[model samples]
Target: MRVDLFDFELPPERIALRPVRPRDSARMLVVEGGAAPFADRRVSDLPSLLRAGDVLVFNDTRVIPAQLEGRRGEASIGATLHKRIDLRRWQAFVRNAKRLKPGDRIDFPQGVTAIAEERHADGSFTLAFGGEEPVEVLLERAGTMPLPPYIAGKRPTDAQDREDYQTMFAREDGAVAAPTAALHFTPELLAALAEAGIASETLTLHVGAGTFLPVKAEDTEAHAMHSEWGRIDAATADRLNAARAAGGRVIAVGTTSLRLLESAAGEDKVIRPFEGDTAIFITPGYRFRAIDGLMTNFHLPKSTLFMLVSALMGLERMQAAYAHAIANEYRFYSYGDSSLLIP
Candidate 1:
């Protein structure tokens, strides 16, 4: 389909710079399948919205302080580490990259530094950190949270974002970006979901900086998704399959979870154990073998995420839903309001 079909006007003020206090206070827009009227709700109402025995799959990948400002002599460079090739090395999108080349050393804060080992076709560099202190440790000392450009461009990332950007489920550390939808969940909400008999499970998908990239492709077919590492163990897969077999719905908490689940599901619709990288590009024509619903933040115009939601619900349905969201003043983007899309 033409990418232009997904385009819409969004007022700049609609973007959320920070989350509401007591995370669960954020508003949620419930969009049902077909011609159902869109419902205005709050994140705290999620448990009541979902049925008993439904499984909510969350991404447990933790966000690292991937944004680093450094210098090679007089040239200032900024790097956002998006993928980890190994313990000591990462693939990063570097600003001031025009001044860098393979084998240049960049000096960062806290005495941390890295060597630009290889430059990829996409202009990202493979950076190898110096010394033996774990890369996470170095990042803690030298880096700041990798805020989405939409937000970062508006203001600086302050200390508050360190906690606000992370979800309650964050555990495995690797993701450059946070699974923003999950950030709305709170301990109180978890207890409510449990009381409502709504089960939850976790998997890992290290969200990359690629999520922030604009879709320059004119058509959906031409767009290529960036690969991000994810994992689902045998036990989790078995549990998910069993839940589905028992008539429970599998609700992915974010596109990250939905994409990973779809990647692991066989044509038979059974999820299997999976590990490694995935560049799953979900478009309107794509068939969803897993996930009965999706809970995610509002996305950018003409973005792959909007395309994914359009695929989950029909294109016309999503277009209308988004129109309702905008008209109702729902926040947009990573730090925005939430939406529970059931199809």
Candidate 2:
């Protein structure tokens, strides 16, 4: 399919710069399968919207401050770590690629520094940190939250983004980006879900900076998705299968979770233990295996995420739904409003 088919006009003001206060107060647009009318609701209404025995799978991968600004011999350089290659080495996208070469040391704040090692064909570099201290500690001292360019381009990142970008379920540390759909969940909403008997589980998918990359491909078939690490243990997979066997629906809290779940499921639709990288590029005509529904934030035009949703529903359905969202003033992108897609 042509990538242009997914394109839509979005007013700049509709892009969200920050999350709403209390988290759950953010509006949610419920889009059902087929020709059902779109329903406007709040994130807090999830407990009532969902039935008992339905499970909401959340991504527990924590966002690391992967954005770094440094200098090499007076030449300014910017880097966003994309994936972990080793305990001390990472593959990163560089801003000043022309100025960097193999073996050049970039000096960051707090004496934290890294050496540019091998450069990839895509112009990314292998960054190896220089220190005995854990790389996490080095990042904490010198790195800042990796906000999506849509929001960061409008305003500077601050201390507020540190907490706002993270979800309550964040634990495992590896992701460069937060599973923004989960950002709308709060303790109060969890309590309500528990009281309502709507079960929730967690999986891990270390979201990379590739999520923010634009689809420059003219056709959807030409687009290649960057891999991201994810995991689903035996116990969790067994539980999810058991829930489904009992006629319960498995709802993914974010596309990261849905992608990971689909990666773990078999052709028979049984989820199994999985641990590795997944570069699943979900587009229209793809068959969903593990998840029954999805709760995610609004996505960018012509993005892989929009393609995924279009697959779950249909191309025409998603196009119309997005039109309604934009017309209704629903916030867009990470740190934006939520949507519950039931297809």
Q: Count the backbone clashes (under 3 Å) in each candidate.
A: 0, 0
Model 1 C-alpha lDDT per residue in residues 247-269, reported as the tens digit of each score: 99999999999999999998999
Weakest ten-residue segment in model 2 by summed lDDT: 29-38
TM-score for candidate 2, residues paired by index: 0.99
Clash pairs detected, candidate 1: none
lDDT of 2 by residue, 217-322 (tens): 9999998889999999999999999999999999999999999999999999999999999999999999999999999999999999999999998999989989
Spell out the clash pairs found in candidate 2: none
lDDT accuracy of residue 192 in candidate 2: 97
C-alpha lDDT (0 to 100) for residue 164 of candidate 1: 95
Candidate 1 ranges beyond 4 A from true positions:
none
Q: What is each predicted model's overall lDDT from 0 to 1?
A: 0.95, 0.95
Error of 2 at 268 (Å): 0.5
Name the lDDT value of residue 92 in candidate 2: 97
**For every candidate, C-alpha RMSD to the true structure in Å:** 0.7, 0.6
